[model samples]
Every structure is written in structure tokens, then in C-alpha cells.
Target: MNTRTLIASALALGFLAACSKPEPVVEAPRPVVVFTLASAQVAPAALYTGEVRARYESDLAFRIGGKIVERRVDVGAVVKPGQLLARLDPADAGLNAEAARAQLAAAENEFAYARAEVLRYRDLVAKNFVSRSVLDAKETAFRSATARVEQARAQASVAGRQAGYTSLLADQPGVITAVGAEVGQVVKDSAVVMKLARDGEREVLIAVPESRIGELKKAGRVEVRLWTQPDVALAGRVREIAPSADAATRTYAVRVSIVDPLPALQLGMTANVVLADAAASAGGLLVPITAVFEHGGASAVWVMQAEGELVKPVLRKVTVRQYREDGALISAGLTAGETIAAAGVNKIIAGQALRPVAPARPAAAPMAVRPGAAS
Candidate 1:
């Protein structure tokens, strides 16, 4: 009884132990798209909409306010220096000029009388016929009269200038782009009467976002093209950059001065500005668009690490400078020669061990054998 029982218990225990040990768990390596990090010549190109404008634009305004009596030219009229653009009533200015002339004449007569009085005072003092104090009094009177005459002369000069200011004349050769006043319109002093685009260097004005302003400033080259003529690419340089961003648009105004502008390049035409910068293209790591994913509201990607013969995926937080159709420009949080997951990011698991296998090649077609040629 003892031998049979022992033998049966031993066999049963062995069978149970074998069944409890689960078959070695085996998992197939998950396939993911991986990209090796490498330095690439990234030509950064940014497109901005711009308007062609005169480099030196002037807003012609009236120095003296008056009722606009007539306008000589319409918008877009070319004018030479000293050409009359418009005029005021002029009757008031003419009256002022005449009054100034009358004052001048009166001052001259007073000056002549002062000179005669001074001569008489000098002669009386020399002859001792009049007391010294009497001569001194006449001399003081003559000096006071002379000061008044000089003041009157200055007043007349200014009045004469104001009379001429009633006529709005072009200070330089230019094309009129705007007229702010019509006939019978009363304008304030220094108010803009006409907008003029001086004939000279042309420029393209663009609004650049705050994010790209730094890159724009550091750009090595700039190019411009008109919307009508795409092939007419012209070279340009940064002529002006706004010191501060616009409060409304939060963009900086940029002016690109054209070099050797063509005669056909006119003001008010739409232009395209392209900035080519080497700052982003010189030294940075670029990954595929799919490689980046959002983590904790920050940018991150799965980096592949070589673990002996196997590959392991580790999460890396990255600072993304810019994103384009091709990929994202990584400003920080990555190093050269790093491998990152290019696709299938959602299927990834933390600390997952993986085997890096090259993408499988297309299977070679089986060679067809001649019918019954060989066994």
C-alpha cells in the first residue's frame, strides 16, 4: 500500500508542476517608423505680403489754415519743384501783406526823423547851447525810435512770407497720391492737404509678426516680386524696421528698399517679400512632422536608444522653434546623432524594449522554371 501510494503521489505532483509553469511568454517587436538625426542645410523661407511705396513720402500740409479756394491738380498728377498744387482764398493774406508794407513805410519815416533828431542833439551838445541832460534825452528818444523801426521791419518780413505760404507749392518733384481738401474746405494749420509720393527710391512695406522679427533681422538676403509679374524678382535690403510692435496687429513694420528698381515698379502695387535666413538653416536638428507629439501641453518625441543589441524608446521633451510642412525645427532638448520615432507614436509605450530592424525589402519573385526542363 505504501509503495503504490508514494508512486501515484509523485507522478501527480510532477504533472501539476509542469502544467503550472506557463509557456515562456513571447511578444513580437512593434514596428515603428524611426529617423536618424542629422544636420541638414535648412533654407528657411518666409513669405510676407507687402505693398510697394515710395521710400520718401511727404504729406504736404498748409502752414497757415485757410479756406481752400481751388485745387490745381487731381490725384496722380506729376509735378516739378515749386509747382502750384493748390491755393487758399489769398484775399486775407494779401491784406496782411499790404498792411505789413504800410507798417514798413511808417517805420522808415520814423527812422528818418530819429536820425535828424540825433544830429540836432549832437550839434547842440557840441556848441554848449543845450544842457547835457537835454541832449541825452533826445539821444534816448532816437534810440527808442530806432528799436521800434527794426521790430516793424521784422514783422513786415514775416508777414510777407506768410502771404506767400497761402499758395501750396511742391517743394520737390513728386507724384500726388492723395488730396485731403476740396474747394471751400477750411483746414487747420499744419493739416495735411495733399499726399505726395516723391519720385526716388521705392520700397516694399510689410508687417512681420513678432515671432519672425528676430529671424528677419538676421536674414542674409531678401527678395521681392510683384504680384502681377512673378518672374521679376528684385533684390532688396532692410531699410527700416519698426522699433516696437504695433498695438493693434502686434506686428512690426518692415521696409525693404529695392535696389535698382525698374521704371515699371510703381507705388501702391502689391508685392511679395521673401527672406532667406541662415540662422535656422545653419545648425539645428530637424525631425519629421509626425515625430513630434504634445505632452503636458509641451512638445515631446520618442528617442531611440541603443541598448546592447536591442533598441529602447525614451521620451524627450523638446523646445520647438518652428513647424513647417516638412518637419519641426528643434531649438533645444535634442542632440545630434539621436534617433527618434518618425511615425506610429500613439502605439508607443514607455520603457518598452524593442529590436531595431531595417525596413524589409520587397520579396524577390520566384524564378520561373522551364516546363519539365529539370527535376
Candidate 2:
């Protein structure tokens, strides 16, 4: 009686304890960061490598053709205005000048003789010793001789200037960036001997591809970051844009001037020209590029539905008119102010529950009130 009664009592106790135990509690919905889609004119930032350059650059050259006798300044030489950069062989220029001087001297002697003859003829005419036509011929001779002398004198002045042109001088204070001609090399008039970058406002030179040329033309907000000093970024504006694309690279040359000058930014420093996505100019709501994913050959975003205690993500197809490197603008399918999952969109699936958390920005559409938000 004891063994059977004890076994049955133990079984009954075990059954009652199991039945009294509460059912397994369901897990709370996963909390997720949900931001309301805002209509902000934002675009992805683009970056391009470039070089820091002077706003004003000029090519120094000889004004007259001659063999270079000496090149005083090399590349990277800082020069002041009127500084002699190079010298040319002045022998030919001097010879031409000398010949011009000799011609002027001979023309002057002829003019003096003609003047004497004109005076003698005038005296004879007044005394009625010569006919009027004869005196007129002498005056014509005098006028011709005087004109020849002036022509020869002008030639001599031009020849003197030609000799002076043999010496190449800097027209402005600048640093020499390039040397195109060397000593013993014969260069023609205006042949670039050196490249001068004037000391002034600094600029960044970048080549924008044809695809991005439109953005350059607008000259939207640009920032230049130096390679040596990545932390230092200078805001800049498009100072000049080439009218046509480069024949070799098929890229347009763009010059961006620094809004504020800094000592660190010098001529020919490697830099990065950052261009903002064309959204500010063209109004559109910006979304993270990663936020939008492609599925079934179509683009879509994950939208949340607010349940009493759970928020569920539902796949919504959106029309994307344009895209940026880091984000995209929703052309259609997403409504302003609706909460959308941005952080872990790939992990989410239809019917997956979540906890809706409001973002910093005000939501256009109210978010689902969390269970504890009622207070």
C-alpha cells in the first residue's frame, strides 16, 4: 500500500506543477532605428584628385627669335617683375640695329643736302633768277629727302627694340613651374621659355569628365582637401571652366579658387576637389544609396507599418529618377514623413516585426508609438 500510494502521489504532484507553470513568454519586437523620409535637397558628395595652382599663370618667352645664350632661372625659381630670366644671342639683333643706324645717317645727309638746295632755289625764285616750276621741283626733292630720313629713323627705333627683346624678363612676381627652352636652343618670338605662376589667390586645377561637366558648369559648392593635410579642407568656387573638353583626355579643365586663403595651400600642392551631388540645385529627397536595393530587376525600399506593439517592414517598390554614390532620391513610391528602415535594410523581410524609434529630424508622417511612449 505504501509503494503504490507514494508513486501515484508523486505523479499527480509533477502533473500539477507542469500545468501551473505559465506558457512560454513571447519575445518583444526587435527595436530598429526608423527615420521619416524627408524632402531634403541633398546629394552624394563626389571627390576628384587635383593640384593646387595659382589663379594667374603666364608663360615667359622671348619677344624676338634668337639662340638662347643663357637660362638664368630653372624650374621652381621665384622671380620678381622685370627680373631677367634668360638671355639670347644678341649678335644678329645688334647687326640689324647697326645697319638701321647707318641707313638713318645716310638718309639724314641726303636730307641736309636737299635742304641746302631748296634754300638756294627759294632765294633765286625771289630774286627772279629762276622759273617757278624749277623752284617747285627743288622743294619736292627736299620733301622726299625729309620723308626718307623719318622712315629710316623709325626703322632704327624698331631695331633697337628688337635687340632689347633678346633678354627674357619676368612680367610679374611668380614661381617658375616649367622650363620649355634651354641654353643653345633657338626659340621663336613668343616661344614659351618658362611657365610663371604669379603669387596671389590659390586655385585647384581638376579635370572633370564629360559626364560630370554639367555639375562643373553650375559651379556648385566645392571643397578642396590637401593630400598632405587631409584634415584641412578649404571651401572653394569654380573660378574658370574650359569651354570645351580636352582633346586628349576628353575632360574639361576646371579651376576652383579658394574662398579663404591659407599659408598651407601653396602652388602645385596635390589636392582633392570635392563636388556635391547635383541635388541642391535640383530639388529632390535624398536617401542613402545603400538604403535602396535591387530585387527582381527593380529598385525598392523597406517601409515600416506601425502595429500596436510591433512595427513590421514591408517591401515597397520606388521609382528612382537619379542616384548618387552614397544615396538616392526617391522619385516615386515613398511618401514624405513615412518611417523607413535605413541601417539594416538587407536583414529585414516582409512581416518581420520591429520597434519603431523616432529620428532626430521631425517626421512628416507620425511614427508608430512604442509601447512605453504612451506616457
Candidate 3:
């Protein structure tokens, strides 16, 4: 059984071992993703939360103090100019007016009697039947009567104005936003009874930081979207900018006038004002927000490159013009139709071989269904 049999068996075992296929090194397939490179008109813009306000708001108040006898209008009621909104009890005012008229009539009668007496005295004085002193005294009496008549006339005018003050009328046509006085409530002079706002001409008032004021000025026209009506976007022009920054907020008050007549727009409604930059809009590049990561004051996006049939993600410097909800507007260093890793960008390094994975879709909230709607 010797050396020849052992050598033959070993040779056969070695040949079998060599002929048996070693465990095949199976390479995983690269993850393929379907993407459409969309060319969108991206605006480089800064967004701010603003409030819609009426162009004219009036604080209606009573000119005179009195107990409110009647309040015809309530808050949110539409009113026209000169419409009666409230009325104070006019009994006292009427009585004063009557007294003033009666006093004026009495003064006029007294003045007339004094004038007749003065005429009789003057005739007698000319006929030498009355002395010069008596004629002089008569003239002085007539003049006193005339003074009394003038005083009565002045009182009557004041009483007339007081009577008119009893009724509070709307000075302008507007919607009543607030009502401060109630029926039978006593109010002092200059106490605001109601707040009126004009029907149309709405504007968004925003407080922009002082640092961004210059940038905002350069971005002339703004697009305003109502918070309640997000789908509806209205155009607005920069109407005014405050001369000085607010002491408390350190921001400048910027007013944007709404150009369209939006009947649905109401005062105090919240709005989003987007200030567009001209220079940034001229450039064309869109990058994923996740890919554009910041580290140590530098911003970058991961660009995928094909390395030996495998895609490798590499970090590339991107000039971010503006930050948006979905992604950042890239001003430079990116071309259209280029693939970039949307997520897992932090772990990836430049020139490192990566198993190209499909970009993760952003999670969305479930939509609320109304009653009787099909699911």
C-alpha cells in the first residue's frame, strides 16, 4: 500500500480541491434611482411672517362726555359715513338749548325796548325837554342791552354744538372692528367708542431686521402669501420703510402695499412676505438641502461620481444664495441634471467608494379627510 498509493490519493485530493469553485466573490449591485432633473425658476428670496392691516383705521370716540343711551352698531358691523353709531341721552342738552334760545329772545326784547327808549330820549333831548345827562344815560343803557343780546347769542351757539355732540356719527365708511361703549354706559370725552377699518386697501406690515434691510431694499418687489390662504399669492410693492430702527426689536418697519383688490383679505391676517434677490435669480442651480451640509463655516453638497461601475459621493463646495423650504438655491459650483446624495451626506467623504443608494423621500404628514370624503 505504500508511497505510490499515498502520492496518487494526495494528487487526486489536490486536483479536486483546485477544481472545486472557490466561494464566488459576489459584488452587490449598485442601487439605481430614477430621477428627473427639473429646471425650475428658483427665486433667491428671504421670507418673513407679516400681518395684513387696513390702510386706514379710525378710532371713533365721543367729543363730549355722557351716558350712552343707545348703541346701534356692534363690532364687525359695516357702517357708512355719517351713520349714527351711538347716541347719548339728549334731555340735558335739549333743555340747555331751550334755555339758551329763551334767554336770547328775552335779551333781544330787552334790547329792542332799550333802543325805543333811547330814541324817545334822543328826540326829547333835541327838543330840550330832556337833559344831556339823561340822553347819555339812555345811550349807555342801550349799549348794555346790546352786549347782553350778544352774550345770549354766544350761549345759544354753544348749546347748539352741545346738542349735536349727543349723537355720535361715523366719520368714514368702514367696518367696525371694535366697540368699547355699551348701552347705558357712561363714557368720558375722547373715550374710544368704536374702531373702524376701511373695507379695501390692505397691506402687509413686516419688521425686517436692520442687517437685512439693505438686502430687502435691493429686492424691490415682494410676493405675499396669506397664511390662511397659502395657495393664493398676491403681489406687493414696497410702500414704505421706517427711517429708524425700532428700539425694542432693533428692526426696521417695512410696509408692503397689496396691489390687488382681495375682498377676502381681512385685517390682522398673517402673511408670508418673500423678498426676491435679482442677482441670485439669474443663476441656475438647485441642490438638496441635506447634501448642502455646513461644517466649520463652510457649506458643501455631496456630488456622486461613477468610479469603476460604482457611484461614489464626493463633497463639493456650493455657493448657497438662499435657504428655501425644500432646498437651497445654489449660485455656483453645480450644474443641472447632476446627481447628488440627498441624505447620509454627513458620513460620506470625498473620493470614498460608496454603495449608491436611492435618495430617501421626505416624510409627509397624513392629510386630514373631511366628513363624507372617500378615503
Candidate 4:
């Protein structure tokens, strides 16, 4: 009786064990591509193309308006101070001068006659021949005539200046960079006839993109190289930076004054401006762009913390100074020798267990087959 009962119990226990669901299998930690923060060298220097220009450029124009009958100098012509660069037709100016002189002569004659009459009146009054009121009237007339004569003389001087303006003269030693008016062209007063670049300090004009403008401002050293002499680098500094971006290009215009510019650095020559940092390690740490994620409107990364052979992702906020094609510069909140998730950051949860893996190397580009080469 005991053997049969034991057999039945064993069968029932076997059936119960088979019917119950097996415990769920524990899953292994998933692999995550991670990047290690290394001591980053300064970002490659930014290069910009620009043109050489004079620090003090002037637009040459006539003080008065007239037809341009003579243009002695063309573009690229160098002139000295008071050198005749161009001229206008002097006939009209000459006629105006002559008319002003004639008016002055007439006014002087009138003033002389009035003075003589006043003197005669004074004498007559002294002799009791003329009344004192008559002498006073003559004196008043003489004063008015004198005033008219002075006014005429002033006008004549202005006319003389106008005549002198007919001949365009260089006020400073410079090279003509542009010519806006030609011979026989009627130009208005103060109209630009040419552009002169004075012989003095030279500068390079460059435009920088808005994104890198801050870097440019904080640049440590600037160097300029002319296209004509690429091998030689001229030291330069930030002379001026546009307060606002350009409307068309959305870039800032920067003027770099060349220090002790060589004679070879001429106007309008193409030049290259290089902006670089002084120290190599000033760039802080560099991390993959994909590794950074936004957390509470601030940049953050999933750092891979190791614990007993297992890596756990810990979210850490970081200060990103700049973003480049290669990576994001970590200026603060991180140090060298830190590991972070490189990609698929959104899929990771804070403190989640993960298997840290090195980033996959980029596939090598296929070599091009040469024509008539072996297959």
C-alpha cells in the first residue's frame, strides 16, 4: 500500500512542476559605443581670405562743379602733395573772377567819392558854410559805401578760390586707386572723381562668419600672408571688429592692421588672415558631437562609470564652448580621461547598466581602379 501511494504522489508532483512557468531569463547588458575625453589640442586655426587696403583712404573730388576737361592721372598713378591730378574747364571760373573783380573796383570808386564828399562837408561845417546835420549824413553814406567795398572784396576772394579749384591737385601723397570721372564728364560739386590711398599704415580687410566671430575676438595671434608673397607672414592685430553683422553675408567685417607693413604689401592684393590660439592645450577637452545631449536646456553627456567590471552610464552636465566638424569643445564640467557614450545617447537611461565598447573605425574608402590595370 505505501509503494502505490508514493508512486501516485511522485506523478502528481512531476505534473505540477511541468505546468508552472519557468522563471524569466536575466538579459546581459547591451553594448554602448563610448568615447574617451582626451586632452584636446587647440582647434585648427581659422583661415580667412581678404584684401589689403590703406588705413586712410580718401575720395578725391572737386570743391566746385564743372565739366572735367583734363584728367592727368589714371588709376594706379602716384601723385605728390599739390600735384595736379585733373582739371575742369577754367573759362566759367575765370569769367566769374573777372566779374567779381569789376564789382570790387566799382565799390571802391564809390567809397572814394563818398569819403571825399564827407571830408568836404566836414570842412564846410567848420567854416560855417554847411550844417552839422549835412556832415553827419555824408559820414553815414561813406560808412555804407565802405561796407559795400568790403563785401565786394570778400566775394572776389571766393571767386578767386573757385578759379583755383578748377585745377584738381592732390592734397597728400597717394596712389590713385579708382577713377569715377573721365575727361569731358560734367561732375557736381563734391562729387567723387577718384579714390586715393594715402601712403601710410596698411591694413587687411576680412569678413568672418558669425559663428566664429567670438573666437576671432579672443584670438591670441593673427598673421597675414599676401598672395604675391605667400611664404612671408606679416604680424597683425585686431584693429577693428564690426559691432554688427553684415546684412547681406551675415558676417562681421574685421580690419587687421599690419605691423610695420613691408613695401610689398600693396593695396588691393589678395591676402590670407590666420587666427590661432597661443597654447596647444587651451582648447580643453573634446568629445564626439553625438555624445552630447540636451538636459534641462543644458548640454549633457552619458559618462560610462566602471563598477566591478561593469560600466554604468551616469548623466553629467557640461559646458560646450564651441561646435566643430569633428566634435564639441568641452570647456567646463569635464576633464581629460573621462569616458562617455558616443552615439545613441537618447536610448540610454541614467545609471543604466551597459557594456562599454570602443567606437567603430570608419570604413576605408575603396581604391579606384586604374584604366587598363589588372582586375
Leading candidate by lDDT: 4
Candidate 2 lands at a TM-score of: 0.65
Better of 3 and 4 by TM-score: 3
| C-alpha local distance difference test of each model | 0.80, 0.80, 0.77, 0.82
Candidate 4: tens digits of C-alpha lDDT, residues 1-375: 699999999999999999999999998988898777654332334468899999899999999999999989989998999999999999999999999999999999999999999989988999999789989999999999999999999999999999999998999998999999999899999999999999988989999888777877786558888888876888888888999989998889999999878876678999988776332124446567888889899999988899876799888999887775346767678776777788999999878788887767942111111123221
Show the colliding residue pairs in model 3: none
Residue 326 lDDT (model 4): 45
Query: Per-residue alpha-carbon lDDT of model 2 for 1-375, expressed as tens digits?
Result: 799999999999999998896889998777776766653322245667888888888987888898999988888898998999999999999999999999999999999999999999999999999999999999999999999999999999999999999888898998999999889998899888889999988988898877787777786568888888876768889988899889999888988888886776678789988776544233445566656888789998888888887788989998776765435766668766776787677778789779877555543322111112211
lDDT accuracy of residue 177 in candidate 2: 97
- Model 1 lDDT on a 0 to 1 scale: 0.80
| CA deviation > 4 Å runs, candidate 1 | 1-44, 277-375
Where is model 3 more than 4 Å wrong at Cα?
1-41, 215-220, 282-375
The residue pairs in collision within model 1 are none
Top-TM-score candidate index: 3
